[model samples]
Target: AQSVSQHNHHVILSEAASLELGCNYSYGGTVNLFWYVQYPGQHLQLLLKYFSGDPLVKGIKGFEAEFIKSKFSFNLRKPSVQWSDTAEYFCARPRGGNTGKLIFGQGTTLQVKP
Candidate 1:
């Protein structure tokens, strides 16, 4: 079965610090990738996604992800982050056959200090 893995389990950063969280998947076929963020006491929000086209995909709030087909990796990056960016991030992908089931990574918690 396909799965997602996040390199960092927890991250602490001060304001205006650059951030890069690694994400990799174990899949050999065509795939769609997504990054979701959940702020404190808030619902999961879609940070960014990469289905096709350009390898570099940008999303809301200065967030972006790159899809490297050769490496089976989709790493999220932000040049600078704010305290408001603190949250839990999850890397995910839909299961095969369009079952609507998603496989998510263990997740990484980012704590941004003011």
Candidate 2:
């Protein structure tokens, strides 16, 4: 079965610390990758995506990720994170075949202490 998994259920970090969240998928064919973040009281927004181009992709708010094809992983990283970066991060993939729905992993909650 095709699915996505986020290794961290919750994270706590001080401001200006480095951040890395693990993500892995179990699909063997072509797939679309996405990272969505929902801040406190805000709607989910696209952090980044990997779709047919370069495997290294950058997104809003100083976030980036690299897609490792052989490992089936797309891990999110940031050099220094701010308190505002605190939010729920969800890794999603578009369902393959005719259905265009999205499959989201159980989100990772990031808490940054100021």
Candidate 3:
């Protein structure tokens, strides 16, 4: 079955520190990858996505991820994080055919201190 996994359930960091969250997927065929972030009380927004072409993709708010096919990993990273960056992050993959649904991984909550 196709599924996404986020390694970190929670993360804490001081303001201006670096950030990296691990993500992995188990799918053999073609797939679409996405990282969605939900701030304190806001709706989820797309952080990044990987469909085809470049393995390394950049998204909103200075975030980026590198897709590794062999490792089946797409890890999110930021050079420096802010207190405002604190939020819940989720990794997702679109279900193949028919449904047009998205399967989300267990979320990772990041707490950034000021």
Deviation of model 1 at 19, angstroms: 0.6
Give a tens-digit lDDT track for model 2, residues 1-114: 679999899999999999999899986556789999999999999999998789999999899999999999999999999999999999989777757678899999999999
Best by TM-score: 1
Between candidates 2 and 3, name the one with more favorable lDDT. 3
Compared with the true structure, what per-residue lDDT tens digits does model 3 show for residues 4-47?
Answer: 99989999999989999999999665678999999998999999
Superposed model 1: Cα runs more than 4 Å off: none
Candidate 3 off by > 4 Å: none
Ordered from best to worst TM-score, the candidate numbers read: 1, 3, 2
Looking at model 1, how many pairs of residues clash? Answer: 0
What CA RMSD would candidate 1 show? 0.9
Tens digit per residue, CA lDDT, model 1, 23-67: 999975559899999999999999998888999999999999999
TM-scores for all candidates: the values are 0.96, 0.95, 0.95
